[model samples]
Target: MGDVNRATTAAARAPKQDRSRATRQRLLEAAVACLAEHGWAGSTVAVVAERAGVSRGAAQHHFPTREDLFTAAVEHVAEERSTALRELFPQGAAGDRRAVVEEIVTLFTGPVFRAALALWVAASNEEQLRGRVTELEARVGRETHRTAVQLLDADESRPGVRETVQGLLDMARGLGLANLLSDDTARRARVVAQWAALIDAALGAPEDA
Candidate 1:
């Protein structure tokens, strides 16, 4: 019984597998909030540590480098936006086309897009963040394209679908920028409606237009 107890104790103390994960999360969330509030120039590892209520050394234990922290932060926010989009759309593979498109547009013109815009702006000024920003973009692009294909009932290999998806992404990005500048929900919806008409025409889907 003593030997068994020792073994259990050893296992319990075994480096706390992934114990740093929560710290990483807190740091990442802090990074995003800091970026949103201060923009890229004011976001520093020390500031993020203070924002997270952790010592700078503790934050460094989780994210050794500022680039790593920013990467994690951008990925976290992107994942959250992706999850929100998934929730807004249908559960099954098959979704209501009109609903999905409108919801997507609304999402793009809302909080998710605003956070992304901040990241984009920050990345534009910081060369170190450029690669991470590109990676985040590629991930979002692939996921968005996959969702669009599934919604449109088009083969991924189809030629026109790629262009359609690109156009939709461009439109969404533009709308997001508009939202940030204008802060007009009604205008954003109207912008989405315009894109909806164009997408409906391109997709040959009658429901949304």
Candidate 2:
């Protein structure tokens, strides 16, 4: 009996596995909140672990490294935001041009974008974070532009059409950043109105025009 017991391995606990995954998710959520609210320096693994109500040892077990944790957290945020965007702006969503533009601007001004901006600023000085941030930014930036173009119902083949769409994304991000330091609300309203009017003129008209 003693020999048999010594040979037995511990069974995999399904509930424990679930709790571990849930803990990891909480850590990621805490990291996002910290990044959005306190910037990169404040989003340490210890801080995230404490915020998630988990031990630092648990955090290290899941992430193994700071870069690993931040990378996974960023990816988690992107996935959540992408899902939200898809649900909010379905494929056939039809609305006023101004309203659509405002919605896109709102998307940029939200917490995910704020978290991304924090990553951007931190990655500038942190070489380890640069590669991951670049990969995510390219993917998210392209998808955002594509979605905005679709919502505008604009002909991308037309001259300068793509540029205009890209400009709108850039403008929204710019406004979001400016909003961090100052209440660029009035300025953003004016810019978005002008951009929406121009898009209406260009896209609402015939492609030949």
Candidate 3:
């Protein structure tokens, strides 16, 4: 009888745990969408709660403040981008490398880029957002440096390697901004290709190779 009661309690708690996880995911995704569409300044708790389809009280229960929500959103976006890159760039058999590179640039030019830029712009006026953005950007830089170092066969501690990684990130950011403000897909793709080739060369991949 005791064992049966314990099993019943465990079964009851399992659904609660799943619901909690789902709620957290919903809030995180809603926060990202809010930040991307409205920028950080406009992404208040009330706004995010509405977007998440939760009560303001419930949202606050998960993320106590707007700053906390924004930070989580940035981290989520960074993780998602990193995961996508890892999946897309599987090892060996470098077939369709150019196309793969293009897809990477497209990801940068999509929602992730918009969300990050919005955070940056909002950070200029908000101290909390500024600090959060700095932390997130540093994490992203480390991730980029790791990938760059692996591809370029250079140590992360090397000066030129850091510069190369930063250059690629900056160029990718610019491509995203250009995509946001322009209607020229052909020109944008050409520019992105040229910039990517430059980074690939720096990574020892070379244009023809």
Candidate 4:
């Protein structure tokens, strides 16, 4: 009887746990969309909760403060972006550096990047958000750099290899910033091709080779 009762209780808790996770995910995704569309001044916990189809109280249950919610949302999306990049190139970016470069650039120009930019702007002005946003940006930057190194099969031990990779990311960010003003598709393709050639010249042999 005791064993059966324990098993029944465990089964009952499973669905509740699943629902809680789903609710949290909805709130995070909603927060990103709100930040992207509405900017920091417009995106409130109440607004995000409405977009998420959850109550404000529930949103707070997941993230007690507005800063907590937005920061966590951006971090969650960044992690998802990294996972997506890896999934898109499961075999690794051995050949076709152009494709890898283009995809990485795409990450910066996407909605998540826009949402993160909004947070960055807000962090610049908001004292309460500065530290968390700074820390989050640092972590995301490190992960992005590590991902680029892996995809490029780069050898950081080599002279200038690290800087070259960092330059690529910086250039991509600049391109993303430019893209925010207008459709830069034509110029972006040209730049991406140029960068791919430059990467090949700079990196020399792939780490595998």
Quote each prediction's TM-score: 0.80, 0.83, 0.84, 0.97
Sliding window of 10 residues with minimal summed lDDT for model 4? 89-98
The digit string of per-residue lDDT tens for model 1 on 1-209 reads 99999999888876675566667778888888787667667778999999888899998887888878776786787677667766665542243455566766665765545556677787888788788888887887788767666655544464575687678877777777776766677876676677766665566542223
Per-residue lDDT for 84-173 in model 4, tens only?
A: 998888878887677889999999997898899999999999999999999999999999999998998889999999999999999988
State candidate 2's TM-score.
0.83
Off by over 4 Å in 4: none
* Candidate 4 TM-score over all chains jointly: 0.97
Clashes per candidate (backbone, < 3 Å) = 0, 0, 0, 0
- For 97-165, candidate 3 gives per-residue lDDT tens digits of 345456656767877677878888888887767877888789887885565444434444544656866
Model 1, runs deviating above 4 Å: 1-19, 90-95, 110-112, 157-159, 205-209
Candidate 1 weakest lDDT stretch, 10 residues? 89-98
RMSD of 1: 3.7
Order of all candidates by lDDT, from best down to worst?
4, 2, 3, 1
**Candidate 1 clash total?**
0
lDDT of 3: 0.72
Which candidate has the highest lDDT of all? Answer: 4
**Deviation in angstroms for 72 in model 1?**
1.1
What ranges in model 3 sit over 4 Å off?
Answer: 92-97, 151-162, 205-209
The whole-model lDDT of each prediction reads 0.71, 0.80, 0.72, 0.93
